[model samples]
Target: MRLSHKLLRDAALFLILISMPVYYLAFTYSLKESSKSRELIVTRQLTSFQNTLKEALWNGDSPYTRQIVSTLGNIEGVSSVVLYDDKMEKIQESNSPSKRIPFSHDMYKELESNQVKQIKTKSEGSFLVSLITKKTDQGLEKLGIIKIDIHYNDLIKSAHARSRTMLAVLLGIFILIFFIQFLYLREFLIKPLSDFEKAISEMNVYADIKLKEDPNHVFEIANLTKTFNHMGEELKNSAGIINQQQMQMINVSKMSALGEMASGVAHEINNPLMITTGFLERIQKAVQNDPEKYSEIAMHTEKALKGTQRVAKIVKGLRSFARNGSKDPMQEVETEKIISETLELCFERFKYGEIQLEITKTVSGKIICRESQISQVLLNLLNNAYDAVTEMPSKNKWVKVEVADSADQNKILIYITDCGPGIPKDIASKILEPFFTTKETGKGTGLGLSISVGIVEEHGGKLYLDHGHDNTRFVLELPRA
Candidate 1:
């Protein structure tokens, strides 16, 4: 059964069980009291009649004796009356047998011993019998007995009336109690539970939420609501922490991939840069012998020399990125310098792949971090941007890297955006997961973003893929010293 019905049924059954014995005792007690009242009335009358009859007999007044006997017989509920001598001989009677007294000496004595008694005297109803002893003038000597039979109807009727009244009162009390109990349960228990269900259904699992505090006076439900609120706050905080850790793991994986890619690029580029530097030095020496030749060739050689130095600087930067591993300590490093160094590794790749690269610096700040790890992260981002643009069918392929101070003065933002087709919405969330990649098999390790994410986290920063843009923009936020 439903809870409401069950509660009501059980309560009704309890009331029934509890009230029956009380009512039974009440009815029985009422009957006994009615009988006692009847006995008292009968005893008093019988004693008065017996005293008058004895006085009449002693005074030799037959008329007075008859008058007294007739009066006692006429009393209400009096079925019969009989006067008996010491030998159990009937002397006077009303409503009795005409032949003889229908009672033995033993019966008379037993009946006389008690003031009143009820007996089922072979009639349809029981009768109350009261006895009075007739004594001499001084009341020292017993003369005879007087026995009166009183109908028990009045006593029975009074008892029945009292029992009915008690039953009616009990029913009213039970109804009132049931009505109040149902209201109590509905307000304090049932309604609150329904509201709780509604609140839970409407809540967003990913968002931070605080449940409304219960305002009930009921102790158990109030405590339960408090516990739910506490547990929900803890879960929301835990989810935030988990999301941060997941981003870290993704960035670190990407950085690890950068180390491997930079190693080969550094070796291949350094040799060419070295030969270009040698040629530039020899050309400057050859032009120095003639004034006209020197003047004309000096500017060209100087430009060529600057070109070699620029290539050499890129080679040196690639070497920094090519380190197999890193365990560097934290230190203050210029934000612009790190971005410039990382671009050296990717600039050649973007040019060779026919992809345009734009670098913008809006703010300059010294950030505290392991330089190698931060450089690796920036390199991996640029490398991914290259890949994104390379795979696109667009004729104008470009990657933009913007470094700016964040709204919070304590932090800086690096925005690496690409002109290629943005990350698919369906796979965006999984992009940072280990071994999760959108690239064709063997073309990507899927760990590039994961490793870079970890590195960002170690520096107490954030790395995340920005959504709702025409192109993908990966943000790296770092704290400044």
Candidate 2:
């Protein structure tokens, strides 16, 4: 069952569990008390009968006693009437044809004791009767005992009837209470929860969904509704921001790829340009002796060609730096050669900033990797290191790159360290996230470290910042090829 329905049912059962036993106990006690009261009335009537019999016995003959006994037997609800002398001998006995007295000695003694008394005993045909008695006189003459057995079967039958009636009433009351509680729960809890569910479903279908406040709901449900609505709105706003960021990243990747391709095309054209420039320089030198001749023309041509060739070379280098070429099949690569190519790309920046670059190679072995991607990762790290050191005071400026084999010779370790203001402890962990930059706005796109991390990961390697030392160190460990 649904949660709300289960809650309501459990509540109803709890009430029944607590209340039913109390109701039964009270009903039973009430029946017993009613029986006791009836017995008291019967005892009083027996006492009056005893007085009449005593008056007749002391004032007249046997005829008067017989008259009094007959009158007592005629009383309503009286099953059997008996008169006994103080010595415990029966004087007179009368009973209806439907009833019979099984024993009277106990009843006589109980009556002669002068205590008003009543008791229950079995009668014929599975029936029960109450026997009661009282003293003969007003504490004067001790007369014979009088006993009256009233049919308790009638009293029990009456009690049973009353119990049945009470049970019916109680069942009706429980039904009414259950109905009222169910209605209250549906209105106060269940309906509100259903509405909240519907609102969520609608929000999933149409973005930026809103739900109206339900005035019919209770305070708690209203608060929950408001919270759900607020959460939906917040999620919608967050989704929009994520979508825009995704688009931006896509555009940036495309631009980077395009820049790389342009660099490669420029490099291809540089070789031909250099050949043309060399031929023009030779022609100019050969014609230098001729005045107003090809010497001047050739010299100017050679200078122009040289300038074009220089431009071509610069373009070629820029293309090589930008292009991220395809990965080559895994093969043994010279670690030193990879480091040299990467450093060559960052040479201009290092020289321009007067930042010293150092490389310490402690191992010389072929490592396994795609040379182009490894070169890109190294280049990016070197470039970042150069930038970090260049930003610091000249006297303290230096960047170091180191390559070594792992202790087991099963892997290679590359470490890039820079002597600059070290990465802050708080922001160090988040530096690898794409588009998260510490640089000034518009100065960095922040994809360099993130992409480098991806490349290293694809090579079955681990890349992390080691803050164990004073200077910031980025360590890359790649598995042996």
Candidate 3:
């Protein structure tokens, strides 16, 4: 449960906690009031008995007075009853033989200001005392008084019975309300909050932020859900801005690398072109001097042709590697040729740096994909391999390129391995992520591997670094057509 929901639940529980006793007390009060009303009715009935006692006294019939007192005593909860004559002398009295109650003289004085008085005794019962008067032509005459004792046990039992019944009823109501509220809150508040927490935890820059729009009746939760969805939308927009900036940065990085390599590429082509021009001039002079020296000129002519072809190959490789802007048309690209040309582009850098290169070709196959894109992937891998090996202190540092058909014959596998300090285990997972690199800041753009991976994946291929090895090795697998 969220803290807010927990607080709400706690508050509800506190209310239930406080309300139970309050309900019980209110019920007790009501029962007590009812008991008092019953007691008042008993008092009234006992007071009415005084009229009978008064009639008997006025007739001077002692037996009738005793009979009246005895009848009043026969009622339930009535322990005893007593009647007094006009002179305050007890003329008639009736008491339960089993449970006797004693009357006090002070009770008579206490009844002076009121028509009825009640006295409670700790051990036996309670006393209901009333005044009896006779009507006369002058006005009213004070005839006598009546006192009745009520058993405490009977009144206590009745009160307890009423209290137990009400408490049971209130308990049922409390439980039903508590369960209904708990289930309601779990569905609307608690479950949604839990799901919201999970959703937030899983949220990322490219994650879809849309959530199920549920009908939650609570205003605060509904508003909070709306705000959360709005925040997700804002975050998504921010992520789009970030991604755009990242793409721009990646483009800049690619251009910077191309600019840096332009000179080396020019040198590679210029050298081959210069050789081809020199060889052609020599062949022309030999042809002009001696038409008879045709065999000697033929060898020079062949060397010149080879030189021109080398220049053409370098230029073609450069063009392929530098191909940019999205629409990469699919074609049958030879994996071996792509790897060789990529190596050719890197040859000038390798020669100047004295980094040894080894090529191992096991099988040749063509794959239907964008040739420039594949060439770009190969160039990136070869350049990264060159850099990796060049950075090492060992003079024997070398990069090996291997192209072979997969065992299943459905795919081509290219392995680029470098005998240099391999990638550290800690940073291996992040190598293909944009802007992640171990190279010195100004020396590396860091988007080489990321871009390479993207291109390979676009062709339904996979590029991955092989871990748990002595040297750094990257594998590229593309489906063969």
Candidate 4:
């Protein structure tokens, strides 16, 4: 059965079970009370009958006595009202109300005591028999006795009828209460829960979206909905962060692969470049004695050597940078060494762009870090600086690198600043966010700052923009060895 029907059924059964004993007790008490009422009424009537007899019999008027007896017999629950003397002589009689009372007349004990009583006598049948004794101021006068047949059985039957009626009323009230409870639970409790379940069943597992709120919900349901919606929002935000982290990892993987290829290619080209440089050196030395025919050849050879050496320097920078140094040993390297080696990877860009580069060493110390990773950080910053001022005129373009110790003397600080317009206040905070960039399309991937931030943090350092600077400046702080 559905929950509504089952709840109602259980409630009804509980009511019936709980009410039966109460009904029985009520019925039993009612019957007892009815019997008491009947007795009291009968007692009062007997007293009145005796008082009437004392008046009538005192006058000794036989017609008046008969008239009182007839009037008494007409009262409710009284079958017959008859009078007799102590010598067993019948004086007056009334017709029986329903049935005749075939009772012995000798038992007039209740009338002797002036209270109501039912006397059992041996006769042809059985019935309620009452008696009364009349008295006067003269003495204990047995003026007359009444034989009243009170209908005890009828009184009991009436009590049973009334008790049954009351039990029926109580049962109806219980049913009505159960029915009302069922409707309330179905509308406010059961149906709302079922609707919530259906909404959940239709929701997508991968999506983090809010469930619609029901304005009519109770506190418990409303609280549940609020918690669910809050959880969905939290999950949605967490998913975005997780996806960014995943993309960062993928990009790092690609860079590591490219680094490995660069390492391999540099190794293959190193021997040929060295051999060619040696041959060109010997040719220049051998042709130096002849000025006329060998001058152009020597000049061309010098140019060839210069270009070849530059290629060699670039190849060496590529090899050094291409090292996957995440697990490399941390060491204390001179501040000058780190800067000079990192510039080798991007020095050509500065020269090609005619961007004046300035280097300042306010404080000198060995920094504790993985050399290759630190070089990567410096290279990224240098490249960004180069790109920043690359669009400006030669005279207007400049980049500065400064090395110093932090105020606490516990960290090494490297500041790279460019003459390009500084990052806007609005976009500055978002620069470190993955895939968020200010550069035009194709010029930047936007992962550089985010990945650099991660790298510096792994090395127990920080990389952040220095808002105090007038131009675009980045501060990289690493622990001092």
Model 2 residue runs over 4 Å out of place are: 4-30, 60-63, 97-115, 120-142, 194-216, 266-481
Q: Which candidate do you rate higher for TM-score, 2 or 3?
A: 3
TM-score of 2: 0.48
lDDT computed for candidate 1? 0.74
Q: Write the per-residue lDDT of candidate 3 for residues 1-481, one digit (tens) a residue.
A: 5565676688668766866686568656765565566567678776676566667777888888778888887877677777776567877777744565666777666666227777766533667777776778987777788777777565566666766677667667866887787788788877888878888998887898666776744787777778888889999989877985787577767665884586468667777687777878777766875767776787768777776877777776775666563486688877777778778877878888888787866578889888767777877888888877887888787888888878988999988898877887789989998778778978776778888888888889999998865789899999997
**Candidate 1, 83-192: lDDT as tens digits:** 65546666677765332224445665576532455554532233444444444467644455666666656656766678779887888887898889889988888776
lDDT of 2 by residue, 155-196 (tens): 666666776677667767877887797889888777777878
* Model 3, runs deviating above 4 Å: 1-52, 58-60, 85-89, 97-107, 110-126, 132-143, 205-210, 215-259, 268-481
TM-scores of the candidates in the order shown? 0.61, 0.48, 0.52, 0.67
Candidate numbers, best lDDT first, in rank order: 4, 3, 1, 2
Candidate 3 Cα deviation (angstroms), residue 418: 37
What is the Cα-based TM-score of model 4? 0.67
C-alpha RMSD by candidate, in order: 8.8, 12.4, 11.4, 6.7
Strongest candidate by TM-score: 4
Best by lDDT: 4
lDDT of each: 0.74, 0.70, 0.76, 0.77
Residue 427, candidate 2: C-alpha displacement in angstroms: 38
Q: Which order, best to worst by TM-score?
A: 4, 1, 3, 2
Model 4: per-residue Cα lDDT over 1-481, one tens digit each: 7787788678878877977676677767876676556656766766666666767777788888888878777766666776776565788878844566665544564344454456533322233443444445876656556666655566567666777788888888878987787778787789877876775776554575566678887788888878877877777678777877787777778788999999989988998999999999999888889888598998899899999988888788788789888889888888778787778667777888888777865577898888888898888888888877887765868898999889999998999999986788989889898788777877687888887998899889999999998889999999888
